[model samples]
Target chain A: MGKNIFRSLLLGLVMVLAIQLVALAADNQFSGVQITVQMQDHSATRAIQKLLPDFEKMTGMKVNLVILPFSAMKEKQLIELASRNATYDVIMLDYRDVAGYGEARWMIDLGQYIKGPLADPNLKLDDFLPTGVQSLTWKNKLYGFPFYIESTMLMYRKDLYDANALKVPENWDELYANALKLNLDTNKDGQVDFYGCTLRGLRAVGYNDYIYNGFLKSFGGSYFDDKWKPIFNNENGMKALETYIKILKDCGPPSVATFGYEEVMQEMMQNKTAQVIDATMLGTWLEDPEKSQVAGKNGYAMVPKGTVQRGNSFFGMGLGIPVFSKNPDAAYKFIEWATSEQVEKSFINEGAFMTRSSVLNTKEFKERWPLFANLIIDSLADANITYTPILPEWREVADFVSIAVSTALIGEKTPKEALDNAAAEVEKVMKKAGYY
Target chain B: MTKTRRDNTPQWILIPTITFILLLTTFPMAYSLYNSVMDTNLLKPYLGSTFIGLGNYFSLLQDGRFWGSVWHTVYITVSTVVIEFLLGLGLALLLNREMAGNRITRTLILIPFMTTPVVIGLIWRFLFNYDLGIINYVFRIFHLPQVLWLSNQSVALKSVVLVDVWQWTPLVALILLAGLQSLPIEPYEASLVDGCTPWQQFRRITLPLLSPSILMVLLIRTMDAIKMYDLIYVLTEGGPGTVTETISYYLYVIGFKLFYTGRAAAGSYILLIIITLISMLFIKLLRGQYQEQP
Candidate 1:
């Protein structure tokens, strides 16, 4: 009796295991092809839901999104690609990640694919705001395709400027002159409650990218020469740092050093600052009265030019394919569809910043988001890819550099001392990681 | 050697406990220790790992960042424990006495202690903001210098410590209060008849009786404080220039952020050793008090 019962139990267990395996197999579409994408969940989980159906319809392939926070997205992409696991077929590689992922043979060389069917006729790759295309390349190989790109522009209260009869400044001298005129302290208050401008100085990578990069670029400071050595503490760099400190201290609110992205956004929304600097992405929310306090009253213009470099900013996310991917053809087709004009139109309609020139010029899109449409194209025109440094170990080095910048801004260390110390530490880390 | 053998009591209890512990604890502990001695990257497999012996440990000893994190962890742990103990004891004494609505007050005290660490951190962060925060608004209205609570490196660590104390002090109070309520009445009566002052009676009779419970609370608090990561992480992110970076936070950034798996393992083992030593010392002290009690 015991032997008979044991045989029956074994048969039941085998049936259950077989059913589970079949369920798992059914969950996978595209049969043998798999792709992974690294994108930020910035607007909750539904950010990617609208585009998935179109991608599937066009290419008949399955995609798996390994969603990450904005803070960790770049670092996660580098680590995952370096392993050559083919863990992701489509990756959201920023300009900073292109150098490392390309050189390491982790990303499939997209030059061959781009010349073929992946290059959509309507979505001309050459027309991708020259600066955006330049950021997606390393040594003639276009490793990534432009997705959403941004350059910082001046966001100001048009009402405040009109009430005070101030023209928007196109240069630093004018900016300072106007800032002084706008520092208003109303109603017998001893303190200056309303400041002219507010910007990020916190110890985070966004602080360095948005605030310090503009200052350095405008001051004629280069991160490295062709030989790759630190040149950021030279005369030009010092002049830039000095100017930044002076402006922030003299015109900014008392707690500017601790202001991060959220704080600056809040301050601008509250109309506490006469002028603020931010990426073009904010234009969508800033123009909506339901979301913004200064909705129609906000003025958009190109970031003012400085001593040498023009008004400078950077590109955002780019798409790349893994070298180990089994179906590079299918993956490239999906990338083409994802960045095509139709998809770009849909995303823009949903309030996402897409980076195809033809899509940005569409009459309907222009009419609906005029403020974003006008300033977005102009800002990208003067964009300099050199301003945002691209190193193989950028994630590690960028953080240390951010800390140094924060210390300088907070008066914990002088600019020269901070940069020198930070550069030395970065060199050491690069050597240890075999980057040099 | 009796004809009727006793049920193997020790063996029955020993077998299940040993099996449970070996599966859950011993295996992971051994695996992590083994990984610490070797240099391996989880992402790469074709490029095989090397056995570095003690190379990772030696490098960590020379790393200034490691020592900085260790010092930060020690400072936070010591400060939190001392403050929590004193404040918790004071509340326990106050609650022990008769008061209006004492039961309601005790229930209210436990509410903060019952909430999760992440919730506590988020609430406190909202309170400490320079703008749109109630604390800052009150300070500004009073003409006081508004503290940049989460921004200034000098003040960020202290702010997190204060949040921790606020959440966990009630736990200590409840434990000490239970101990106070359980003390015998004869000692107090005897001390009063001996003409001892209130301070003397507290020192001579009440404290001696409460030593065991106090020692128990200290041990538990020290262990919990050494492992504090979530609260500090959510509060400041080891920042304002890594001023609040504790040992666990450093390990997390290296392991998960930088993908330095070998280095992170070594750092974690160092933390384990320090915590173990602390626990052992507290247990020894508690054992001494237990033996001294009657």
Candidate 2:
């Protein structure tokens, strides 16, 4: 009886081993395949890199990661796509670039892949943040998988506000009033030691517009009408420009006009500024004890309401397979794995923002970044990409607007004159692009 | 027969180098020239490359930003070159004398020149930062009001020039020092025997002899300054209302950011023409100076 029982146990172990081999074979079907991924140098990409070895081991596929800074990455991707180089199988694409890439047919539509063999019941597209998914979709065709979403929000020093008995700003007027009130010289050195607020003021094309467009949109200003006519020189547009310039000039740092995202975040993190209306990404950096002095002393809010609208700006960084990719199948496999719910949760734990609603709603995430998770959800409702037009000429138009806004900031031109000049230039650009 | 073969061998060796150079430079240049006259909008390629003769040039001529950028380029080039030359000449003269740690000082001066331009730009950007910069900190120590080095439109261009001067002045000094070391001691001795004062000797003997090196340095630096991108790109990015938007930076915006290939090519050709003209004028002046020399 004992010999018969031992023989039965050995047979059971062999059957289990055979089933595991078959499962491994199915998962590693594309073993030995190599795909190159091009991405921007960011914390999210770094997290993906850390997970790549596990992916390689599981799928038996090799991933060659090429990470570059944001601007250089875009330029490289553009050059590669234009040249039809099959150098990169996967690329990190900005949602703002969807229109240009989609219209150019440079990226493959992943809609079919979603419903086909790569589809997993657990990987639901509906689970992603609606704005993020919509941004990556052009003409009802999904061109990429949303990786992370970002929107503008108001971040202020909670300690400072409570100590001063100041209320969280609900509108532009209150924001400006609070900024002026908080612009204090804490050291009493006859100079303002701490600024009240900071925003992006760099004059590069599309840079300043990213932050200032919130003001423009909230003031009932639109970049262009349906006919592509320049409309930013209207009364509302001038008011928006004036308000943006006035606030920065009066309550912001003396060098506010030179501040970009990095500068503003640094200012706030170092506790030199009491408030900042900037990117959601700044919240994560500011909460880190390693980089920030006031890690837990911050309060998050949706961008203050403008006169006519909140005009919050929304953008997403996504992953897309280029049309020129040689290993599209393997590339899709990797993209799916990287954007999977499991990986997204891991990414969040590693301090990356997530685009999936499920991951964001998870008890674990809410407990980790309690302040930002709630603010992100609230801000997404009012966030609009109209501030950044989704067109090929959008970059050029944003540049013109940035120049105008910067000119107003530096007193080179009045808000009205600057907007008028920018409008004329934009019209010229549109005409040249055959937008008649 | 052997002499003829030897001569032919040199030609054969020269052919490969010439071919390589032409392939690298001439092809892109010709393509740019062709593209300048054609509607080659990468975004609107469906429109096809149409021959639009002088259309881009005419548009650029009417472009106020283009003209503004050209003016900025001229201002930056002239100011940087002038300041660098003066400062370099002064340092070169000082170093030319017998002094303690002269070799160490010369090597130290070359450090800025040795550093990458992009790195130099970043370092200077931090140093000139309005709030946290060491410059403003020093000003604060003296109880002086803070100056908006990069934020003020009037001061932004000057701040960029200061960075350029800091980086390239060492190069100019090195070049002028080499020239100073090569100068004949006999002329100085003769000038001293003639009871010439130090200032007089320098203004006459030193300045005349250093003119060739000065002109060479000016020529090289002018070309570089006109095409200055990395410094301005990293430092101010032609910010503070485009006060520092040099021609090259503007062309980069048109090409890469705007993706107006045809317009960018045309703008580049225009810049090329300006650079060629300026270089030719400098060459002519240099030739005249050479001819004036005994």
Candidate 3:
């Protein structure tokens, strides 16, 4: 009778413990709420999705994903998020858009969630690249988690460089010389199949802002002065632009001025160019043999020095939670988990770059892919993390400026004339919009 | 206009229909007009907007890009419709005759017409890519001047026109084919008996008979071509130095991309006026034919 009673009591205790554990897991798992994320295609989406099983196992939270093309995703997400439908629980945002979204109160102020010494003991804020962690903040308030932050650097074909007995260019003059040498008529057909270098000069938003802004910043020209005056037409800015345009003409593909991100990617993939200044995210595609012919034959280097600076590449996108989410607490929990070092390791295992400093410098990751790990970390660390000061007026300013540049490059207008015209139009936009 | 009084029909049906028209059409038109007078940027909705009255319209009048786009729209609309109408009429006549495999040919002709504009634009964009395009491939095959199809500002409009022709010419052919099918065979036989040549018969009798259908096709195509958006948006997005920027493209840039609601509204009102005038002119041209009908 004593043995039977003891056995029954022990069994009951075990069952009670099991039931409590299940209830605790259920509480963390989101109680079956479906959180949708509107994100762009980079290494991050696959990495995040890879963790879904584990997420469900640990928290019981189910994540629904809707990944869109980068351009389409931005337009659709902004329209939906701005209208306050909260259709997306999480969204991918660049530093430039953080201010706009934050000011509009579209994104949750994640300061409280990520504050007080990193919320969760497992997830440390200091583990992230300092700039990347800082980039997600607007008005000194955290609004996003740094997913896969990126900036541009010069990528060249190592095989091509060795075969031609050439060296990496350090400055504009050296770059021009290298470009001339690399612009070889390989088959002596008089038609240049392999161009020296290329950059996106297309009128797309990416080209207009990121690529052109890279050039503008490299020339030591800020969009606005301390008082927010348009400095795009300043002397250093104009000189930088002229040199950039000239170099593009001499070095780039025949129709590069019209090439967008996709076009530049094609040129690099086909090994038709000696070098290209593109986002480090391209390393993922370049390393994939199926995606690139020059896979494993590429070398990474810092972007060439311009007249005013060495390089002025900027960070791209990060994961953000919208403010109108019905389940902010659950969303915050998921974010903390996703941005954790464990998640970063998972991303590295799946061939994705993580913005976390802890994962980026790990001995294991460095051994797997030294150049990629270095390039991403270096760019994110050194990049100009300031959101474009003219972010609010960028949509209109970009179009007007691109038109001017296009005209000048095509020889329809002189650089002076083009810059003057563009400045006039931009000034009018600022005045009408109450910016100036 | 006479309002039809119904006896058996319910007034509620008209009520719903009228409400729908007001909601979908009239309300938007009124809203646009109101927005045109106010300097509202949808992207910055919190900013206190000021009423600018006719300032936006006045500014648009002086805007060079606006005028350039207007000219581009005219060029595209005129060139595409005229060429398509001619080609379409020829195809319609050819199909009207007893020929081998007419059913298959008709179905094949409808394929391009049935494709979504976005898909058509993407397909053509790939086909015309200067670097890795089939059109350039064919050019290499035939030893032709490998034209910079979308890159060269001077020729981008022509490239877009070519795509428009490829897709919409079939529409014209089908409509004209209907008109050709409905025509009496006796008139052609009588003309043949009178020693009239094929060209003469076509010019005198067939053309006169086809006038109503041709006018309808022209008017519809003119309006559509004027409002052209999807294919152009997908293909070039009014790129390569604004060479292919049409009125609709300008409006989209101003409204959606640039968030200049007032300017876009002003642009649409101008477009509305132009379309209305053209419609009136077409109606006047077709008045005599309709007057002699039932």
Candidate 4:
């Protein structure tokens, strides 16, 4: 009877202890805490949304993810930030906008959180591409964490080129020649059924200027001098305009002037356009058999060289916690988790291109996206961001440039006339901004 | 005291609605007016804003792009309103007559107006596409030369105007048809007894009586067309080198895209002044027409 009583008492004590431990572990760490994240509708964001349940479970915090179309997202974010609204705790920012956003102090200085105890050491900040990190830094202060880095490259139909015994174009001259030779009228309809190439010609600051700057930089033209004087009206600038118009008008599709990324991508994937010069992210889409008719027949190469140099435009999208966020620490945690190596690896497996070197160089990633891996590294080596000025007034200037280039493309004005007019407008904007 | 209390009841009932309108409309107007006189650029807040009275307005007058956008707006508004009025009036006249399928046709015509402007823009953009558009395919079948509807600068503005006409012409027609139905039959019977031709009856009686409806449709459509943004934004985005950049679209680019709040505010005020003047002119003409009739 004494032994039975002792055993029963010990078992009850052990059960009580076990129940107490379970209650402690299940306790809400961030109960009642909610953070809203504003991001563009992209594959990466979709992947992030899929993993957010895990985040909520771990921290006991709620997340409100607001995804919007690309253009609408930028406008909404700008409005929210400018209004000093704490509505969005986290925001997705294009690297090009960092200068403008950081200068306004709209985003929190993330250096502290990055170096503090909240940061995971495994993130290995140095593993991010230098260009991606550099673009997101303004005045030597990091404002955001890198999401994905992108550069422009040439995407072409390999079967068409190989069957025609054509070598990949090395320079503008060869590009023009190859384009003209490959512009075929398959049904002899007198109209070319296959366009030589399709490039972004939409007259928007982001759509047209992004691709045109690559040509501008490669042609040895600069947007502004060291003192911030507009110099794109110079000889080289005019030459770039002339060459761009000539090639696009002569060899491109009839409606190339209205084509943005979607139109260009669709045309190439449908086997309607023989080549395209666009963002590096397009390679993955082009290789997807479900969306592409020329999947295995596609070839990747560096952007064509110009008279003076060969260059690529570097850009990326990053995530930043807004200065108005009420839950800064929680927001930081989410950013850290979302951009971690393990999460980025999964993102890569789901076909999201990431900025981390480890993600791009991993054996599985390289094998799955070999073309993109090779092209991204090669293009990053020669990519330049100077073409699109990293100034607060850069967007205004780009608007004028987009109009000038588009007008010239449609044969409305001579290249010199259009560029000079745009230069004058840019000068006025700069003068008003006190850049004189 | 009781009579005064009863009078106050209406004011009390109206207070909430009046307050709502003032909050939604007057507050934003006042705020924009204040912002217009300040040098405010959201992206350059470090520079800070200063009361630069009339600075933004002065710069706008000197800005060529501002004037160019104004010209484009006026051009598009005039072309769309004029064409829509003519086609709408013609359709209204035809539909007013006794016809077998009038009911179905009336309902079918409302489809375009029922559709969203952005969706209409997208559908038209695909139809006007140069390479793979069904419109071009039809033209090829007929051996007619394909036109670059959205690419060529000369035709891009016209294409946008065409889209506006397609969507809003039905609304105008319906308004006019209601006006036509309400018109007395005595004048037409008298004209027929006097051996008057159909054209003479339409000009002398029908047109004079229909002037009020015509003016009403004109005022509504003109206002909407002048502030048009969505269709243009989705279709051409003021492309082919600002050939179609309307004033409202320019204001949007300045305010949202460039974050030049001060300049955009000034631009909006200028547009407001223009619209107000146009409305006053139309109302004065409408009042004169009413007085002249009775």
Whole-model lDDT values for every prediction:
0.76, 0.87, 0.79, 0.88
Give the lDDT ranking, best first: 4, 2, 3, 1
Residue pair clashes in candidate 3:
A29-A59, A29-A60
lDDT digits (tens) for residues A328-435 of candidate 3: 777777778877888788677666456777788888788777766776666666687753562567667767778766766656677778777878888887777666
Model 4 lDDT per residue over A46-106, tens place: 9999999888777767899999999899999988888899999999988878988988889
Off by over 4 Å in 4: A1-28, B1-7
Chain B structural similarity as TM-score, candidate 2: 0.95
Candidate 2 vs 4: which has more lDDT? 4
Q: Is the docking of candidate 2 incorrect, acceptable, medium or high quality?
A: medium
Instruction: After the best TM-score superposition of candidate 3, give how far the Cα of residue B9 lies from its true spot, in angstroms.
Output: 4.7
iRMSD (1 decimal) for each model: 3.6, 1.5, 1.8, 0.9
Model 4 interface root-mean-square deviation: 0.9
Docking quality category of candidate 3 according to DockQ thresholds: acceptable
Rank the models by TM-score, top first.
Answer: 4, 2, 3, 1
Q: Report the alpha-carbon TM-score of model 3 versus the true structure.
A: 0.91
Please provide, for model 3 over B189-240, each residue's C-alpha lDDT reduced to its tens digit, 9 standing for 90 to 100: 9989999998999999899888889999999999999999887799888877
TM-score (all chains, Cα) for each model: 0.86, 0.93, 0.91, 0.94
Correct interface contacts retained, every candidate: 0.27, 0.76, 0.25, 0.90
Instruction: Considering the two chains of model 1, state its CAPRI-style docking category.
Output: acceptable
Give the alpha carbon lDDT tens digit for every residue of B249-292 in model 4: 98998898888899899999999999999999999989988999
Winner of 3 and 4 under DockQ: 4
Question: What tens digits encode model 2's per-residue C-alpha lDDT throughout A88-168?
Answer: 999998887888888888899999898887676777889888888889988988988998778889999999999999999
